[model samples]
Target: MSTAPHLEAGGLLLIADESLSPALVEQAAPVLAQGGLALCQGPGSPSGPRRLVLFDGKLTPTHAEALRGEPPALLLATRASDGRPSTWEARLLGDLLRGAPLLPAGASRHRLQSVADISAAGGAAARAVTQAGGSRTAAALVADVVHELAANAMWDAPVDSRGQHRYAHRRSEVREVAPEDACELAYAVEEGRMWLEVVDRFGGLRPGPFARALGGWG
Candidate 1:
C-alpha cells in the first residue's frame, strides 16, 4: 500500500500498473464475493470471485495485461522501495497462500476496555508468545501489532451521532473505554504461523472521512 498503486473500482480491488487501462477492470466483477480468493495470472481479471496477482511490482506492459479482475489481490511486491518485499508483506502473502485460516478458531483472546489495558495486552502477548516457544523478537512484533490495533479500535474507530470522532483527540489522555466501546485482541501460534486479530465493536471508521465512514446512510 505504501508504494504500490491500488484502486477500488467495479467492486474490484485493483493492484497493478498505473499505466494499465481502466478497461482491464471493466470485465471483472467482485471476485471476493464467494469468500474464497483466486490467484489469477495474466490479463482478464477473474470474472468471478478471484483475485489477480502480479509477480512484478514494476509491472511492464505484459504484466499490466495480467490485470483483469480485482479479487483482493496480494502481490508479492518484488522490489518495493527496497530490493525485496517488506518482511510483513512477504509473511502475510505467504500466510494467506499457505491456506491457514487468518484467525484460527482456537486462538487465545483478550479484551481492552481502557487505555491502561492496551499496555497490559502488549505485555501479555510477549509472555504468551514466549511460553509458546516463540523468540522475543517474534513476541515483540505481535505485541506491537496488538498495541496498535487496540489504539486504532478505541480511538480511530469511534464516531458520534453528529459524525465526529468520539475520542480521537483524547487519544493522548488515558481513560477507560465504556463497555460498549471496548475492543478485543486475539492471537494464535501454530508450528509455523502466528495470527493476530483485533475486533472493534464499532465499524465506525471509514476510508478517510466521517461521511464515507458512516456509509451511504450517513
Candidate 2:
C-alpha cells in the first residue's frame, strides 16, 4: 500500500457532509482560500499526502469514529462558522501546508526529565520569545503552553506492558521522569510565527478519546 501525498501549501481537501448548509460553506471557503489552501467538498479520497480538514459544524462521535483508524498527522476538525481560523488552527495549518517542523529552524531544544526541567524549559522558551520582541504576555502564554505540553508528555504518556498509563492515577506530586522516558522540548520563532513542539517517544494519543474529552461527547 502506498501512502497519500502530503498536503502542500495549496492542496487541502475539505470534507463536508452533504447536508451541510450552503451558508457555512460560503463562510469557510474564503478562509481556506486566503490561507492558500485548496478546498473541495464531500469524502472523495485524494491521492498523496493531503491534509484532511473536516468541517462538520462540530466534531462528533461519528466524525471521530471515521478518523479513528488513520494516523493522526495533519488532520484538523473545525466548526462550520463565518469566522476565519483560530490562531492555534492557523498555526497548525501553516505547519502542515509548508511541511514545517513542529519546532522551526534554529529552535532551542531541551531534554526534559522532571517537573523542574519542564519549568526551566518553559522559562527558557518565554525568555526567547521576549528577547525576540514578542510581548511579555505572549511570552508568558507560550511558556504556560510549553509547561502544559511537558506535563502531558511526562505524566500522561508512559504505558506499561499491559497498556496502562503508569502515572494515570497518580496524585499531583513531584515525580522523577526516567531518562529513557524523557521528553524533548523545542521552540523557535521565525517569520512572525512561534513554533513549539513537545515530543514523547511513545505515541499513545488516541483520536476518539481526545475528541470525546474535548467535545463532551460522553
Candidate 3:
C-alpha cells in the first residue's frame, strides 16, 4: 500500500485590523490562497482551521466554525505608524510559525470594555496557549486579533468628548503592552478554543466601521 501525499489543508484567514489598508490585505490574499488558504473581510470563517487571520473585529458564527479544529501556523506583524510592516515583526511571525508546538485543546473567550485592554487580553490568551502546550502560532493569532480590535476601538468607538479617540498620537508604551492601560474586560479559557468579545455601552448607540469589517472576516 502506498501512503497518500500530504495535502495542505484549506482554511480561512480573516482580516480585522482596520489599521491595515484594504489594498495591503487584498495583496496578501493571493499568496495565502496559493497555499490553499483564503482571506475573509469579516468574523465568520470556515469550520476547519486552515489559516484565519483576524485583524480587528468581532467573531461571528462562521468565524467560530472555522476555528474549531487545529489551525495552521499563524503569521502576525507589527506595523509602523505609517502603516508599513516592520522588519522585526515580519521576522518574529515567520520564526514563530516555522517552529512552534501545538496545544490541541484549549478555547478562550474574551470581552473587553475599552480599547486599552485589548493587547493585554491578547497577550494573556497567547500565553495560555503556550502554557497549554499548543503551537505559538495559535497563541499569536489570538493576540494579534485582540491587538487589532483594540486599535480600531480606540480610534473608532464613540467618545464623550472627542468622538472615540483614545490615543491621538501613537505612543510606544501603549502599543507595546495594551492591557496595562487598555481597560478591564472579560475573558475565558477552556478546552482548545477561544472567543473574544469587546463590549461597550456605546455599542448600541452606533456601530462603527470595525463591526462591518468583522462581518466580512467570516
Question: Which lDDT values do the candidates have, in the order given?
Answer: 0.58, 0.64, 0.46
Q: Give the least accurate 10-residue stretch of model 1, judged by summed lDDT.
A: 26-35
Residues 104-167, candidate 1: write the lDDT tens digits: 5688888888877888888887888898888989889888888888899988787777878878
Ranked candidates, highest lDDT first: 2, 1, 3
- Residues 76-156, model 3: lDDT tens digits: 342445343444344334443445322222334454544445656778878877777778898898788767765555434
Off-target runs (Cα >4 Å) in candidate 3 are 1-118, 161-183, 204-218
The C-alpha TM-scores of every prediction are 0.57, 0.66, 0.35
TM-score of 1: 0.57
Q: Judged by lDDT, which candidate is best?
A: 2
By the TM-score metric, which is better: model 2 or model 3?
2
Candidate 2 displacement at residue 150 in angstroms: 0.3
How far out, in Å, is residue 94 in model 3?
Answer: 38
Which of candidates 1 and 2 reaches a greater lDDT?
2
